[model samples]
Target chain A: MALAEPPLGRTTAPTRPAPQKVWVERIPPIWWVLGLFLLTLPAYANDFILFQVFGWTFILGMIALSLMFLAGYGGMVSLIQMSVAAMAGYMVAIFGTSGIAAISMDLPWWLYIPIAILIAAIFGTIVGALAVRTEGIYTIMITLAIAAAFFYFTRQNYTIFNGYTGFNLVVPPQLFGIDWRQPVPFYYLTLGWAAISYGVVIYVSRAPFGLALQGIRDNPRRMAALGFNVTAHRVAAYTFASVIAALAGILLVWQNAQIAPGTAGIPAVIDILVIAVIGGIGRPIGPFVGALIYVLLRTFSPDVLLTFGLSGERFKLLIGLGFLALVFFSPDGVLGLWDRWRARQARRGDPLTGEKGE
Target chain B: MKAFVTRHPTWSLIIGFVVAVLLWLIFAPWTEGMEDVLGRKRVFLNAIFGGVTLGALYFLVASGFTLIFGLMRNVNLAHGSLYLLGGYIGFEVSERTGSWLLAFPVVFVVVALLGLVLQNQVFRRMEGEELRQTMVTIGLSVVLADIMLWIWGGQSYTIFAPDWLSGPMTLPIVSGYRSSGEAVMLKYPAVRMAILFAAIVVGVAMWLILNRSRLGMLIRAGVDDREMLAASGVRIQYVFLAVFGFGAGLAGMAGIVGGTFQSLSPGEDTRFLLASLVVVIVGGMGSIPGAAIGALVIGLAEQLGLVYAPTYSVVFTFLIMAAVLAFRPQGLLGRA
Candidate 1:
């Protein structure tokens, strides 16, 4: 089950039927209009909403994509992915030109980013090495313990992490004398990084390593017998995911203008898990869609509830109810449902394929 | 005798403890005024006491988690939510009735009923699907926590115990050295002692029920081979419901004791959940003695770490987990 080896060399050969021709005809014109409307939303949306809501969502969604890589493809449900990202973010703040004993002593941007990303990847590798031994719930628990350990350490140690306040040391540097924090600039920056990450993820999902990882997921014993080295693949997946998360971490610090323990604590970690599942674990685009929904909900729910004579904190109740409903009704999440509907329409339009009369 | 010693594990445990105590005594300072200033003697006693009390809470919660894991093979992530909900229910009940005794049992029963309903309605539908169950339970946990937040608000609450248990009491043990070479008196919290007693009783009862009863026999059999039991016409679903309810009830009991020991906050649910998960993982799942040992080790480590390395207390727990996982992947009491 080596994931039907990626059609790499045959990319231009048309070895298989094009997926678009099979499914695109079934989608209604209204759906196309809806897609167009969404694509044009940034132009109409307010700056406050764009910068605060959409910007934050993109950053968080990228982090969730890292977790989605592990849980959906690698069959490793970890709770420490955010902690790893936070670790990297904290490192940037420590190494950048703000802390008392900055690691870089004002090192150049090129040197700092690579060092932070490397450290995060190494940390993720160690966590994966420890985690790959256990399966199922044990992996979750171990990762959680690691995250909890990091959270407590960051909260208490003042010298390195700047204690509870964390490091408010770093902000996105001005490139070519342009302040990147502006809504449109920051949005583009985030969107560019997200697109790069999504591209890499899609490529990896079709790569040989990804195929082997999927084989391990489907049946580890069988894969192990076939000399696939399941544990190594899992650790590699984690390392790869950590690289993506570290990139997101850099963007996150830029978005927030600070790195605090709260950024990487248990709640934030769980929120990433929730975002990944909500977006739909089946595809990379799921994180973006889920993030959009979450960001909208979080931003508007409080104000909406306040208008309805309810306290803003009560908005969590609504979110919780919505999450449970989503899990119960659509375990594959919104994307899964959308895919099913599209397939159904495609089949209906083509009676031959629908009725097995082809 | 050598064979007997090797076969019976208790002999090795006794030997280990004796050697550990001897090492501690040889290393521990015994000078006048040193104990008074550093309070090392009292600290040791306090740490042990804290460990045991915390271990009791861990036992209550982890036992349920392990039981559910053993019987249903489903990691009930919502177990912590049930514990938190139990605390909130007890808090509300006590506030309304002005009676702690009535509040405790009422909360337990209510949570048990909730557990039963959840098993019948939600978990039963998710049989044989571990990942789906995880998501559903996690969703349930989030929903429950949010509902609790809405109902209880974000303020931390403390339960009031009886007057006698509220204050610290001086114990008869006089083991510390004063400046003038006299023994100094030490005080311990009476509530902690009470919790320890409750934990021991619960442990003993669980041991007896799990080892000596017919229901326990069926549970053990089912855990070993659910398909076999199903083929044999045994009602596995009923057993699952019972196990789930009982585990939830145990968590409720732990919550009441924990609320009294530590203040109840909205966030304590996840904290305790993590602690319980750590315990069950370190301890062998489905093994009562394993839970007890795991809880004690974690409890002591946490207390000692808090005293010595407050910043790295959680690291000690993780270290233990990593070590255990590296060497004994099935846990101390788990069958290989």
Candidate 2:
């Protein structure tokens, strides 16, 4: 898609309006089928599949989507998204009711949710301000350090964070006389939020703000020369990404029924990056696809390892090797591999790839 | 130094005052008033030594990190994994050979060879692609960590110092007054002091080599301008290989030092990686002296914070990093 092209050159020059198209015709049939499949999967899927697999995928996808928004579009590979998400999760447990009555304020859902997002957003903005001070690769290093600090602080501070053993039994509130924690309900809940976030990202990608961000990513100097506030745009991108991450975090806590330091630990932070990269950081849909792969591997790798006469704990090794291979062979991840294959198929009528002339 | 003083006279004065106070606290025997205001002189002395020694270890790890980044522009995130790997290998070597000193050369060779392979094979393929190289390192660290865990298991391992270095050595500093009017000398672990001395030697030798030697000139030139260096007919690949291998080797050796003082575990890789990252950030990227000063600051902050404010020690370290980042994004010693 040549995302690096500046979107400001061909701006609204007060010319005649472009032709309008029907919204229904814009979407391909494949998307409609995929959407329908996802929406109706709970009807036949088991409770385990509904609650654990798909629910976890959507939550992780949303978080990774936030990462893609920054890295793919804004050219900032931030490792702090997981930390921000964890902050939101922790805020929910702290502000809303939780297992620890002494620390948690026991506020209502409506009050605490917004407060959680707000606090997490501010935290992300501060991190963003600090990070945007540096350029390119420094962003990853700075964000990783800050993320580690957040983890360590959360683990050490017993007053507010409750220390090592964090909040537990933090289920979603029953808003409409329905248990949101149930497999079916949770599946639908995560699906709705994930769909909304995905839509938001897709919508924003073509918007002026997103275009400016892409332009800045390509050449900050040029963007600044064009009278854009480079730092402000970058920091604002973090704020926007943080909101998405925070929302995912809230859902993540509800899914787990707990929140702990491990949720946003170094490994977990890296895992988000892995998901985004492996899925393909070039597009918003990549994170969701990557999340699904990660969730499936995480859920099923243990059994697969045992079957191979290896310890189930070797799933990390498997994931590591796979990631290494992917980075080596296809830097843009699975999506890149798919893209090349499609391009090759388009070049020739290949029976092996099952492609005909377009 | 004169230029720095002239450039920021106020900063120089504040720094001079701080240094003066620190010297007084370290050298002068605390009176009752001083002892009351601060805790005991012995505790303060111990923290100072501890922090300095810890800083030495950090310098060992971070110097390599900075050097690698400086020469190759490769952010070797797996540098910590190299450290942990070296620790594990050092443990095995010492355990089998029954000689702690033998582990250094062996681990250095093995890990440095691994570094050579990574540079020549992996990173060289994706030259100039900074983000891809970083991703590969992250993946490498993960794979190496898991492999180490698979082989070493989840248990922690601590390499024992040789017999001569194991026991406590007394220093000339006055710890306190005895009831019979005798001065109580301060005693600390002999191994830590020896390690500290070794680190100083290494740091000095590296500085001398980099600043004074032809090889260092090549490296410095490469850092300043790789394309120019290459155009000058220098085999820049060899420079990259040597720096990467040497840095990896240094990190491996630091693993032995860390394993000697602190136990090596699965998560130590990440901890030390973060330490190196923070150190480089605070010290300034690709600057050896910066790494040293940053390490000292962070190490001191950590130990002192641990001693006085146990809960908020991490906070203090984080605050220093934040302040440095806020003020000088290039780092304390980094070139813009």
Predicted candidate 1 versus true structure: per-residue lDDT over B1-336, tens digit per residue: 477568977968787797698456434545657666655777766776687788888988898898899888888888888888888788888888888778778987999999999899998987887877877877777778888887788899888877777778776666466779787666788888888888899899988888899888889898899999989998888888888899998898788778888988887888888888889879987777888989988998898788767777777888998898888888878877
**What TM-score would every model get versus the actual structure?**
0.90, 0.96
The weakest ten consecutive residues by lDDT in model 1 chain B span B22-31
Cα TM-score of candidate 2: 0.96
Across B14-43, the per-residue lDDT of candidate 2 in tens digits comes to: 999999999888877778898898899999
Position A293, candidate 1: lDDT: 85
Query: How accurate locally is residue A14 in candidate 2, as Cα lDDT from 0 to 100?
Result: 48
**Which is the leading candidate under TM-score?**
2
- Given candidate 1, what's the lDDT at residue A163? 78
lDDT of 1 by residue, A174-198 (tens): 7878888888788778877887898
Going through the candidates in order, the fraction of native interface contacts each one reproduces equals: 0.67, 0.91
Clash tally, candidates in order: 0, 0
lDDT (C-alpha, whole model) for all candidates: 0.82, 0.94
Scoring each candidate complex against the real one, what DockQ results?
A: 0.63, 0.90
